[model samples]
Target: MNLSRPLDSAGGTDDSLGGSLAFGVVKSERQRVGVLAVLIVLLIAALLWSVFGPVVMQPELREKVRASLPFGIGMLTVMFLYECTSFGWLTQLIRKGYEPVYWVRVVNAVIEPLFFTAVLAFLIVFVGPLNGMAGPAPYIYFPYLALSALSLSLRLSLVSGITAAIGFNVAAFFAVHGLEATPSTAVLVSFPHYGMKGILIVLTGLAAGYVGHRLRKQLGESLKVARERDRAVSIFGQHVSPSVADRLLHQSVELTGEERQVCVMFVDIRDFSNLAAAKLPGEIVEYLNQLFGPMIQVVNDHGGIVNKFLGDGFMAVFGAPSEDLKLARNAVACAREILSSTDRLVAAGEIPPTRLGIGLHVGVAITGNVGSEQRKEYTVIGDTVNVAARIEQATKQFRAQLLVSDAVAEQCGPDVAGAVDLGLVELKGQPKPVHLYQLV
Candidate 1:
């Protein structure tokens, strides 16, 4: 049996993590929309104030303000429609399990500046000539360009900047050459100044694009590291406690093989062969899942790492990959919890009456990743693991539910003070007799 395969394979750690990341993306998008809505409201209020204040204070300015009102309304309407469409498109892309296109970003980057340029043109051509109040449109390019750099990619920001510059130059040309009724010597004199502003616009775009490029690169690297950490946690977290997994991720503990004192535990389902013979294959698998689920949880909760699963049992270790001073006690506590949980399951009629043989031994073992380059398993090996298995088998002869070597009993302190000693047991394949203890 492949112990690496989780009991609930369909809803493993990877699926849970992926679901969480997707939810985070959705939440972030919703927040962006909310912010955009607030900004739109503020813009509308400002426009209303500007248009109404002039009309009440000076009656002569009413016609000028009214003429600009239609342009303002048109620009705002376009902006609102664009925002709605962009938000809808982004939502649809996420639902379909795809990232939104770069063009969407380009549109968002360019639209605001484009609208601003249109408003400037409206003022110069319609409002300015009527009221004789326009000189040069306020430099909307710099502020909008800065916003684009922060929120967009290098290419998108640069393209938006260039587009704004071109639009401004076109409107300025039409204002000076096409709209003026009397050709003035002053227009030619200011031509060089306007040309310098155009050059500055292009330079600003390049600088902002470079900053955007660097920011995007940094953000990508940060996200990559976060994803790697998440993947490591999801994979390692299955076999070990979360704290152990975290330590492994942060390199706080060495993963390479090392000799350490470990408490190895072996748990076997007694008479499992008979149970399998009496039921269908699917039923046997379901029963095993029901049996192992809580058992694994108990081991994890007690700070024991489940190393591997045998055909009808599993091996767990306390103090591998990371060290614990009370490994023997934790192993014993985990075994007791498993037994208690099994009794409850039987009483609830979730499974037939069942018995488990649990064994524990504390000794020096080599712990590390073991297996081929293509596949590896983190586990423990040495005489300690072998002794633990032998102790588990001796439970059948002694008619006991739990057995542990003298070393484990001694290390467990007062927790096993009431344990009964089964002395001088001759274990198979061992020349020396080993002292054993049984939990009543």
Candidate 2:
């Protein structure tokens, strides 16, 4: 017997997650560029103010500011160039792929620390004492550490912290020496003070690194779970409806075997063997595709799952994964639609004219995962399923397009319109006879 499996969905969850990550990376890069642009604008404004402000309000500071102008311009130029290069690098990285590589994180860790170091060096050697603004130089470490912590890499964050601390101490030493009339006493006293500041920088780096590491670990775990859930949904969706697949992934119901009242449907193409013998393999497959495609959609639309495809046919089930009170009605409606669709296809010359026999029965059946440990299939098994198949076979003898057991017709209520009672007929392998109905 041929078993028709549910058709696979068009896209998988991996594609979805991949697209999301790509968009996120592009957004991050754009944000970085925007921030850099803003910083460059602010720096240009500051440089303009420094040059012209002293001339207007602090005439005594005018010469000093002019003396520091060249150094300020040089520092700003370096920063601008670095930011532009960093932006270019980000664009290139995104163009290649959005995966977060170790080297990229390392580069990110080093760049900010190096830039701040350059700024500190310039402040100590030129901008600070020359302009009489040296007090705030030591306080720059806080923001540097704060920004570094955002990298989400413990090693990189720690590296940035240590580099900033060393740079700060080096800048402080140079500033102290430049101010000292006598170097010996000044150097000794400055060493201990800068040494304490270095210790604080290290502690801050450690604390930030620890927190970042923990957060990154948690975020990774959450992402892993989401990916697994997406994958499960994709795979399970092939066997069941998307809504049912989602519920399965979320553990709303157990997949272990259980007996449930379900309506089983079997549809077989009549004279399929004769058609196959006359046509090429490709033509046969094309013909089947044209036939099965619409039939599957009809089943899906009426809340029936096309559980399996037998070589020349397929089996559908209703109310297995979840109970459906209207399953019998839905199955009957689905069968009607399938017959109409096949007729349309044949008339349109898309598929050769063919006859189909469908059988539906409603009863309690064992439904769930069935197979080996390595492989399993979620399906229904029991007399209801077998009886449905037998009823389908009976269609050939009776020369009827559709047949349903008394149980199915009863469950269908008023939905089985134009159905003619076939009276009591003994189905194969059954001790008692079953009343069948043929849909007009």
Candidate 3:
């Protein structure tokens, strides 16, 4: 019922479905209003013609004019009706990601017009003869029949002017020859001639529809591709860190928190300051994205929540109000995963090979909204977070790629075997010197 990004694991929900439907309804109504406006214009022209034209005119000319008006109006009406059908079907097809311009639509267009034209032809032929036989010799029943056929065909074709002219003349010729039953001085009408003309028009429509359908199909494919490309570029530009923009994009997830023990990881790229100082702002952002993409992927795969993204790094918190208790293990796994994935990225010439330092700590922390009421962030704040950052910083002194505090090492348990003593180190903002270990 819902629509979502193809990359997202969770399929869309009812809300997305509702949103799509609302947009579709609005668009359909707008089109309908436009069609109504056009019909109104036709009405105004019809009214003006009725008022200006004389009631009594030349017999031949009067017949021609009367026939012509209905022919044009009937065709226009049929065209409007079919357009509504085609437009509605096409909208649904495009929205659902299907190519609607297939052989089927062509077939429908042909069949629809033919069916409508045949109905008009039958009414004209059957009705015209009865009216003519009972009426005066100057009765314009034949012209009326010709006009009805012309209008039905012309409207169906959507090219009324020249086509209607040719058709009217042709129908008049056939009527004169086929209805020889009446005296030379009397007017006559032939149902058989109208029937034959209907068959011809239907056949012509089939051919035209087939060709038009193919052209529409090709044009639709190119148009779809171009629009998709534009959409992709727009999505990419709109992409933001899930931590910041997830609330806006996904309305389903409740953006709230409860106090709980959580594993926190603070990671920073080595020599990040020097790199930023050398590169331009745009280059720096691009470079950071290249380095951060894989690292972020590792965290997300391990079921960790990215809390905040720093300029040259990101802060990840595992096991919070919305996380599993085994968040410490997940964090350690993520760090190892990031280290492994970076090797491939370096070889691809995307990002330079650089060492990443991560500090992991697990303990009771006031993990919730922090900062002033005007602007707040969901983060972990306590000795546990501070200790994690200190241990990671210890990596520089020990000449190690990864470093863990005594608390994190304890949580890691017997699974973590290789460890080197970094001795006691004065942690900033803390009174006591904390013991650190290097993962050898």
Candidate 4:
């Protein structure tokens, strides 16, 4: 049996990665809200100081305060409501029903920077052209610029940053023209001076973009790893040990498509059909669970993985998902240990008395991820696998508990020392006879 993915009602595969990405998006949105809240608090503190405290009591400013304060407060309120509501809507969309829309998120990224532009315009209208351009209003862009990095997109950050700079310079241009005399010669809004500030803002955005780009790359890799891990757990069940999973993903061992030299082992319960017929289905399942659980652990400890469980037994592999120089040897060692473990379990009365037949062979085989776009499986399939299964069946004919092909006998290290040569045995459905050795 192969691992298969469950299809959704819409005929789509589960979008685990997309769900993870949405989680990241939610975090960024929350951060943006924090940034905006901080800005509002700072603005409120500045207004309170100017209106009550002695920070700014300039004769020219006192009369203009009342007019400017209402518009400033209004702008802040609108910004707060817009962002909080948008954030709420996005959070609900992700948490409740639909997948996040890309264009909607991108639009939000574009709109956030525009708030600073509105603030700049407000400042120009309240304070004089030159004074407003030089005031803290322009500095508000800094926090907003930094917030863009949360998108983990360089292009979005750069576009948002550079666009704000141009908008600022444009507002400055129109305001400077408000002066009737020497407007062109005004040094504060001069192209050279103001252009340098604009350049600095653009540069800061570029840096933030680079940071976001790096973060995006790292997050993608982390999500991919998490998806693979969840997939493995889904296929193998909770009883499958981590050691078995680790073998498939240890350093330099990727489960990509390729041909590799592998040791294939087929294990089966001898006379399982006869034994199962006497018991209820539930009892059969319980017996199999009790018997196979520890045997699978033995396979894991010996650097082999039970690829998939058959009704009565399992097919295990060595050196496919992970490279093992001792693959043939490990497969041989693992098979012997399983035989010992089975006898112990039966004697302990943990499971009904039973017998197992195991066959091992080492040869080149095609091993990798296979299946449809929605369903994928990492498995071994080749002549070596076929021969190994055939050998397991031959065990009853030869009256042996375990058998290994000539290739396994040669490559399986010291385990071959006492292997009894069974000579050429013609396996069923095979064109030629196979040389076999009995280990038990």
Candidate 5:
């Protein structure tokens, strides 16, 4: 799920979390561009208010504020245009799945605060140095500094904050130097006041950066968890009941090897080789598909899963994982349903006339993921599994469509107790004969 893009060298992407943070960066830049436009509109509105509305001030002070307006507006206009173009470029890169570069963000962060400094410079040129050193011009830096947090990047936030502090202090210091000859200017040019203000701006930048970084980190982790959950469901859900699949994935059921009592069912198509021998491969495949499709649904409906296909037949297990105590009864019900379903298929002429052999057994078996790391399988492997297969084979000798070991019959009691006893049958490779019962 790590979606890495090759835009890092171009400085157009964030590859730190495998390009996960790139989209957020681009989205933040687009928002910053909109902020610039709003700031310009507000500046123009202030200019209009100053020009047309009744504003009381000394003629020199009024001219000073008016003089700073054009300079401030022009600088903002240039910055806005630059930001709009940069946002467009980042948008283009993102559409192509490239990582957006950081240089544009880096440049914008450092340069944007200096626009207010330019307004301060114009104030020094047109008015007494007091307005430049201790006035409203430095306040403009705070808005953009606050916006740096929207980038979800601590570095960019800090850069914007630091630039604002440096630019404001430099402009204020120059204004103080201009008042050197004035004896009254001594009280007005306070270094500690300006220095304390600069420190607070830098601290604000640091705090904003920390918040942005934390937000970005949380987003990355949440995306990872969701993707991993989807992957598990996609890969493992096919072979199990949906309920079982959910429990296994959510850690309620373990996939690792463990001993659990289960009811195992093995189903085999009778004389399938002879039936397939005369037909074309495709024809035979279609025939098998028709028979098996509904049979699989029957298994799933009975709290079971067709764990794996064994060529002409498949092995299904009831209880799905190991949580159901009713596995024996469910497996018995599923076998009878499969038999009824096949009858309906043949009756409707949906498939060729077919016969089935089903065997059910109940016992402790080792169930878990088996095979190599690259090619693993979830399965049951033990005497219980072997006995189930053997019982399916004996169905031919007994002339029965369904058979169950005494263990399964006993477990299910009344529902399965009526099964006709087939006597102690000596199954192949068994040390002793197993009590078998016929259901068909």
Candidate 6:
């Protein structure tokens, strides 16, 4: 089925295709966001380790490492918990809402300083292997730094702010100790400062675990969103078509500026004027609405867009909005369905035997959105539209219910065996004559 035609032309809705596409986009974006975050963090961590070396222990090295580890560990833990909470929050928000602003984020921000100070301060007081701390000064530095990190994290998303704070703290620590600079030519390397060394090792391992946890949490959340989007789109696609609903959900519009071959079909009820004259206006409208239901089903079943209802007639198109090789086949199928349904209606005495004329033609057309900013419709506009209409008019002269241009017949291949040739005729207002075929 080909569905890339104008919706208003036939007066129908397309939700199936649109919905599927929408869900796909949402899923992809969510996954990409998670993957990108992980990659960026990995890069920053690699750079930090490279510039600062594996471990620092002496008094000089201890001070430098203390400053840097907080930022790294602080960021890692904050982002980890944020992602875990964010997933739950987002899912709840979408389904209903169970209060996203909880204590998790607040606690995450507060914990960085508490954890850093506890570990570093305890090491300074008990072990005293590195340079001796000046009373609470060393301990105060850790909390002060942690609070600063927490404050920075509040402005950005928990993940982004944490990462930035970590990066900033690390750079400042390394800069203050001249770790980023070349080794001092005059001073020789000192012995390992056991307390500083133990603290540094502990912080790095914890930070790594924290970062890994965040990565896992983010990936899990992304996967959930993808699955949900897919499930929703699938269910929604069943109601309308996937195509239209997907577009609406994802908020995407295709504007491909390329001319392409298309199959156009136009149908009109015979003696519509007489029917309207005999019946009340409301009755006529009600009857037309009922008729439109079946017609729309037929058209959409064959992957066509119901463009518009012009008075007593309706227009449909295939191979545009998007294109496919089965455009003409779909149109032909639609015509057959219409004929069969109308015949049943006539036999049941619901209305007079419908004298329908379906025009089919294949040609190049400018297929896209048409109309001004306030009122735009997706449709094709070109000579092909005119030719299809004329072929419709020719159905009367040919004594056939369906008239197709030679262009359409060629595309139909063996299925066109039952069609009869209609000699080339000069259509009204046409510069060139067109060859037509009648489907018996």
Which candidate tops TM-score? 1
lDDT of 2 at 356: 95
lDDT of 2 by residue, 356-387 (tens): 99998999999876665556567789999999
Superposed by TM-score, candidate 6 places the C-alpha of residue 94 at a distance from the truth, in angstroms, of: 6.8
- Best candidate, lDDT-wise? 5
lDDT of 4 by residue, 1-440 (tens): 31111222122434766556556655665566666767777776776677677764677775566567777777777877787776676556545534344565666666766776886788678876776787777887777778778877788788878887887778778877645546655677465577778888888889888988898778878978888877876565444345444444443434466788899888899889999999999999899889888888888888887887788888999986778999988888898899999999888988888999998888999976666555555678989899999999999898788999999888865778988999999998778999999996
Model 6, position 408: C-alpha lDDT score:
82
Residue clash pairs of candidate 2: 2-309, 2-310, 2-311, 3-308, 3-309, 3-310, 4-308, 4-309, 4-310, 5-309
Which lDDT values do the candidates have, in the order given? 0.73, 0.72, 0.55, 0.76, 0.77, 0.57
Ranked candidates, highest lDDT first: 5, 4, 1, 2, 6, 3
After superposing candidate 1, which stretches have Cα over 4 Å from the reference? 1-144, 153-189, 206-256
Better of 2 and 5 by lDDT: 5
In TM-score terms, candidate 6 sits at 0.51
Write the number of the candidate with greater TM-score, choosing between 4 and 6: 4
Candidate 6: regions farther than 4 A off: 1-113, 125-260, 297-303, 341-353, 365-382, 422-434
**Stronger candidate by lDDT (2 vs 3):** 2
* lDDT (Cα, tens digit) per residue for candidate 5, span 18-75: 4555566666666766776677678767765765579766777777677766776676
What lDDT does candidate 3 reach at residue 254?
42
Which residue segments of model 3 deviate by more than 4 Å? 1-257, 370-376, 421-424
Question: 339-385 in candidate 1: lDDT tens per residue?
Answer: 99999999999998899999999999997655655555566899989
lDDT of predicted model 1: 0.73
Using all chains and alpha carbons, the TM-scores for the candidates as numbered come to: 0.61, 0.60, 0.45, 0.53, 0.55, 0.51
Q: Count the backbone clashes (under 3 Å) in each candidate.
A: 0, 10, 2, 0, 6, 29
Tens digit of per-residue lDDT, candidate 3, span 67-169: 6455545654665566566556546644653322224433442443343333234324433533323323212222222222211223323332223323433
Task: State in Å the error of residue 410, model 3.
Answer: 2.5
